[model samples]
Target: MGYLALFAVGVTKFLLGKNKNEQIAMDWRKNAVQVFRQEFDHVGCNSDAQSLALMQRSYSEYEYFASGRQNVFYAEANLSLRKRHCLFTTLLFDLTSQTEDLVQFNIPLNLPKNMPLEFLVCRRKDLKGRVSKLTNPGNFIKNPNSKHFKLSEAEASSKNSLMVLAEHDEISNNLIDQEVGLVLAKYGSLINLIHVTDLKQYNNFPLFLRAELQLTSESEEAQYTLLGLMLRLADNVAAYRMSQTVVQKCEKSRKQQKQEEQMQVKQAQ
Candidate 1:
């Protein structure tokens, strides 16, 4: 009788929690769609909620939010989210405290001119944690090499918790100018990483910019500020040009990377 009563209480609590989560998801979807449609001329979104198991009833699971616009600095932009999915699995993996819900933005660009190099600037704290645990749709750096720069040194001196990884020092130095520094200094806590690259196998664009941010705030102003920062970054990347010699070096590195990829494929076959 006692076990049956406890089971009844557990199931009731689960159902109530599920209903609450569904309502919140619906509200979030509505607000997000309205926000993007206001910014874009032709905006589209996917508000479909992911199917969850009985153990996952307490969490929001995965929800996808996408939007796009033409005649802008970027051709299209979209957001994807992954949150607490399964309670038992999460506990088993020891990801209870570590799982800070991920909110990532992918903006594909159609630049009239090409950037000769690719670069990444990210929060140093996420190097071995939240950002690293994510999958391809959000992951930019498959291999963190010598290019992480001396961000460790910068982190020591400054209040900023950011890191830069670039094809060359010239690209990183030029891209992270005064304007960017000011933005980072002010709102550095909200951002995870910003990557400008043509190398993502999932994206077809010649060049694209991706940012992972923690949009936990429900305030409209905070959301707008985050979105605005992303736009500024896209514009900056679109407008940058390196010296001819630096461009040649970047192109050479790209070729070597391609040849290595091809060789790896041949070896696997």
Candidate 2:
């Protein structure tokens, strides 16, 4: 349903084009469509990215707000962090439906209300099927209350989504980081896109993606913890894009193969 709305915006934009300019500009169209038609689609980004960039720029300029949406989120410090870049994701909406005079759409990201340190991770290789130096599945427990409890290898392997005991440093590969009452990080919810959300504003991508990070101290730099998260989001995006490419290739191959088979049958007849 959402994708259909975005597609409609793209079609509308193609009919009514925007003037290419130096200032920040956003439109309802797929800004890359022209380049796509010319086979140089990698040229620019869409309106969604532009809006996000503007929001980021606003934070860079004013840099302060007592409360409301502009409040200083600790993760915003990551914007100046080393070896990292700002990453934002948003929901795409059509502007056409909202106004008759306006020809653009609005894109807003579902920013986290608090700094959550949890994100989801799929099992790369089942421990039961393979042998390695990694910790045994049975030796770890996910809940802080059950720190000493051990999960059986049989029980762990059978489950698809294992609740990662994230807040505790003892058990790593945590999918959710919960300390006290606040959630720090979390993986994707039940949806199509993979999500990495936090409780505080993620001005840049989170850092904890490389390693399982459970904050031991309240003073720890939240910006750095999110770095690993940002990297992991990149991995997820890359994997999703690769799957799309593979699917396109398979579709083309199937079409060609079908045509060839039809030709052969006609010739035999």
Candidate 1 residue pairs in clash (backbone atoms < 3 Å): none
Compose the digit string of candidate 2's lDDT tens values, residues 82-136.
Answer: 1111111112222223211111111112232323233333332322332122222
Residue 227 lDDT, candidate 1, scale 0-100:
66
| Model 2: how far residue 157 lies from native, Å | 4.6
Question: What are the lDDT figures for the candidates, one per model?
Answer: 0.56, 0.28
Give stretches of model 2 more than 4 Å off. 1-10, 13-160, 163-269
Candidate 1 lDDT by residue in tens digits, 1-269: 99898678666656665565555455444455454555554344323322111112235543433344442443233333232333344445535454444456677765677765577766655555634432222323332343322334546455447665666666665666666666666666777778777666447677777777765545555455666666666666666777898778777766776787789899999
Best by TM-score, which number? Answer: 1
